[model samples]
Target: MFNLIRKDVIALKYYFLFIAAYAVMFGLFTVSSFSPLMICMLPAIMMTLFASNLELRNKSMLFIGSLPVRRKQIVLAKYGSVFVYLALGIILAAAIRAINEYGLGVEFPLTSLNLSLSAALAMAFAALYYPIQFWLGVRNSSFISFLVIFLAAALIGGIGNMADSLTFDMLPTRAQLVIGLPIAGLLLLYVSYRISLNLFLRKDIEG
Candidate 1:
């Protein structure tokens, strides 16, 4: 499993440079709290797609399956890579926010809320994205994923001001939402993972 994960990391070695560039670009340019989170997650999403493609392009699916690894392990490692990338994105977002706040003496408003919102959204995205990719194959599903990401970004960018203007009384309390959103997102991701595993197992058995 670790080697599977490592294979993805190695395959995407050059892409990390682009991911870093994206982090810096969005971190510096995006003013809205939630929007920054969206920006930070973009690379992670793209990286997950790229990693999955790496396997598909080389027929690593059959190769890995022919090895000692289980089909379930392969599915788990694929989904697990998404989580790992998300964690890295969150860390990068936090670091960028901290630098903006303390090092640059600029304020990053709603830092915690932004992190939570971004994470929940990312998880929701993965929950939707993986099943499509797994079922349709990445080649067929990539456009749909791109479209979803674009729509999400448009919503966040367009509605950020309205979201910022809303009073605390109009929405759930920060404490509640911060915990609730991530939990919901996690549940969705878990469900997606299970579905993907079942799909993979079914296909493997048939093959």
Candidate 2:
């Protein structure tokens, strides 16, 4: 399982330079309270899609299914990889925030609220994504995922104004919300993993 996770990481090594460049460009130019959240999420989303598509293109899952590992381990490793991407997204987002706050003197800061929200949102997206990826297979899943993400982004954008005004100081139970979002996200992931595991186990890998 750890090796599977490491394989996913190594597969994306070539993209690090491009990911950094994309982050820096978006960070410096995009001036919105939501920008940090997007910065924190887009990488995870993009990488998830990219890896899924790559695997589908190469029939990698079929090969992986032939390995000594169990389907459950494969599913768990893929879930683990999501965390790796999320961590990368957070680091890049924080770095961008730091550069903007100090180097460019941008008023846009990556607040803890933003971080928490983004992390939760990323997990939420993953929860929605993995089951579909397994059930439909990656080839079809990518299109559906894109549609879902687009709709989600549009919905979020509609409420962006309201979200922009939100702050830790504004909420009565700010600490709980901050801590709870990620917890909820994890719960969602756990449920999603179970669904995906069942789906993958029953799936016809040779198809």
Candidate 3:
């Protein structure tokens, strides 16, 4: 399972430099208006898509299916890779946020709210994405992934805008939100994993 998780990372090793550069460029370009959440979450989402595309193109799943590992492990590894990408995104975003906040004199900081929201949003996205990807196959799921990405971007942007005007007094306390969202996201991911595992077990791997 760990090897499967590492395979996704290793497959994208050459692209990490490019990903970092893109993160920096994206942060600089959108820092003023975009939510910090976008910076933190988009990379994870995009990398998952890229990894899927790569795996599909290489027919990696068929090879993996022939190995000793169970379908359950494959599903778990894929789900685990989502977090690996998320952790990478957070690190990259934190660097960008630091530069923006201190070096560039911008006010955007890596608050707990931003971190929790990023985790929640990314997990929610994985929850929706994996089952579809497994059910339809990666190539067939491309259109759906794009639509999800578009909607996620729009939703997060709207949240960023709303954050400025919304009063915390009417909502749950900051601590509650900080705690609740990630928990919700994890539950979503668990449900998604079960669905994906079932779909994968039933899938026929084409050699």
lDDT of 3 by residue, 1-207 (tens): 999999889999977887788888778666654556777787788888888878878988778878999888888998998899889989988888888887988776678898998899999888888888888876675776787777767876887788778786766788998999999999989999999889988887543
lDDT by candidate, in order shown? 0.73, 0.81, 0.83
Using lDDT, give the best candidate's number.
3
Q: Candidate 1 has what TM-score?
A: 0.81
Per candidate, the number of residue pairs that clash is 0, 0, 0
Candidate 3 achieves a global lDDT of 0.83
**Model 1 lDDT per residue over 52-149, tens place:** 66666766766676788887788788777877787778777777778788888766663666667777777777777777666765556457667667
For model 2 the local lDDT of residue 204 reads 73
**Residue 171 CA error for candidate 2 (Å)?**
6.5
Give per-residue lDDT, candidate 1, residue 9.
88
As for model 2, its CA RMSD to the true structure in angstroms is 3.3
Q: After superposition, how far is residue 73 of candidate 2 from its true place, in Å?
A: 0.7
- What's the candidate order when arranged by decreasing lDDT? 3, 2, 1
2 against 3, candidate with superior lDDT: 3
Task: Return the clash pairs for model 3, or none.
Answer: none
Error of 3 at 50 (Å): 0.1
* For model 2, the run of ten residues with the poorest summed lDDT: 168-177
Segments in model 1 whose C-alpha atoms lie over 4 Å from true places: 29-35, 139-141, 147-170, 205-207
